[model samples]
Target: MESQPILATGRLLLRPFTLADAPEVQRLAGDYAVSATTLLPYPYPDGLAEVWIASLREGAERGDAAAFAVTLARGGDLIGGVRLQIDAEHSRGELGFWIAQACWGRGYATEAVGAVIGYGFSALGLHRVHAIHFSRNPASGRVMEKCGMVHEGRLRQHVRKWGVYEDVDLWGIVSPIRAEIPHPLRSMPV
Candidate 1:
């Protein structure tokens, strides 16, 4: 498979991860505020970031997933990461992301996710892209909403996190055609 290309947005750049990014990944993703809200383990172990970055290439090669390092377009500082876990047979992918705690509420997550969702639909020819967040983290859901993703439904106690079952909210956006049509019970747009 061809390598994932760098994606650009108005204020952000989504590019392939590099070994040099390990330090910052460790620093930002290590925080419980970041890790606890996602699947990442708390007290992030040493060298795990490097291991994760290395696996991204392998996953891409196997056509299973693609991960991107989210950075600033101007200064190129690594601030977060986003990923698309592909299910090619179904023409869909699962989206996931995290931003540094310091960058919260700045619209960076929405910008980065929008760029990747565009890539999934336009570049990868995907039919749909979906994401889920722990129910406690509504901010993450807001990012999905801002990217035009509709709230699909909530999975009750669907995931075991930190020894507790956590509810998850699923959100998704289908291709443009699917987005335009109204449901059978709903009136058409004027």
Candidate 2:
């Protein structure tokens, strides 16, 4: 696959990460509130954002994953990120996202997620897009719900984070059928 394509939505834009975004990525993703809910390591480590951004394009090229920087449509300010980890053989992908704590409750996560799911099913030909969130964070689950993903199930102590085990809630959406309907014909007298 080539570089990930830019995805635009009504209120936001989803574009591939660039090295120039590292500083803001670190500033937003480094917060304890952000890192605590995500897989990002705490204290966020120096240069890690740049390193991660640098790896994204190659991963996209290899069909392994695609990560996008979520930004405001009007000002183009980086606010967060969303990613899809692909499973080509199964025609599926796992969706993950994080918005800065300051940007939470603004519907940004839900909007960004919807766009990515659309791209996954329509552009990438994915059959299913799924997501999992730490059970403690119902807000993330709410975002998934708003995007039309159904609650699949929950895994008890499925993830160990910050030296503690956390339950995970799984959610998913399958591509909807788009077959055309046949037009009705006039009936002839028998």
Highest lDDT, which number? 1
The TM-score between candidate 1 and the true structure equals: 0.91
Q: For model 1, how does the per-residue alpha-carbon lDDT over 14-80 read when each residue is reduced to its tens digit?
A: 9999999998999898989998899988888999999999999999999879898999999999999
TM-score of each model, paired residue for residue: 0.91, 0.92
Clash pairs, candidate 1, are none
Question: All candidates: CA RMSD in angstroms?
Answer: 4.7, 6.2
lDDT of 2 by residue, 1-190 (tens): 8667899999998999999999998889999999898889889888999899988878898897989899999999999999999999988899989999998998999999999999998888888899999999999999999999999999999999999999999999988742233325635444
Candidate 2, poorest ten consecutive residues by summed lDDT = 177-186
Q: In candidate 2, residue 156 scores what lDDT?
A: 98
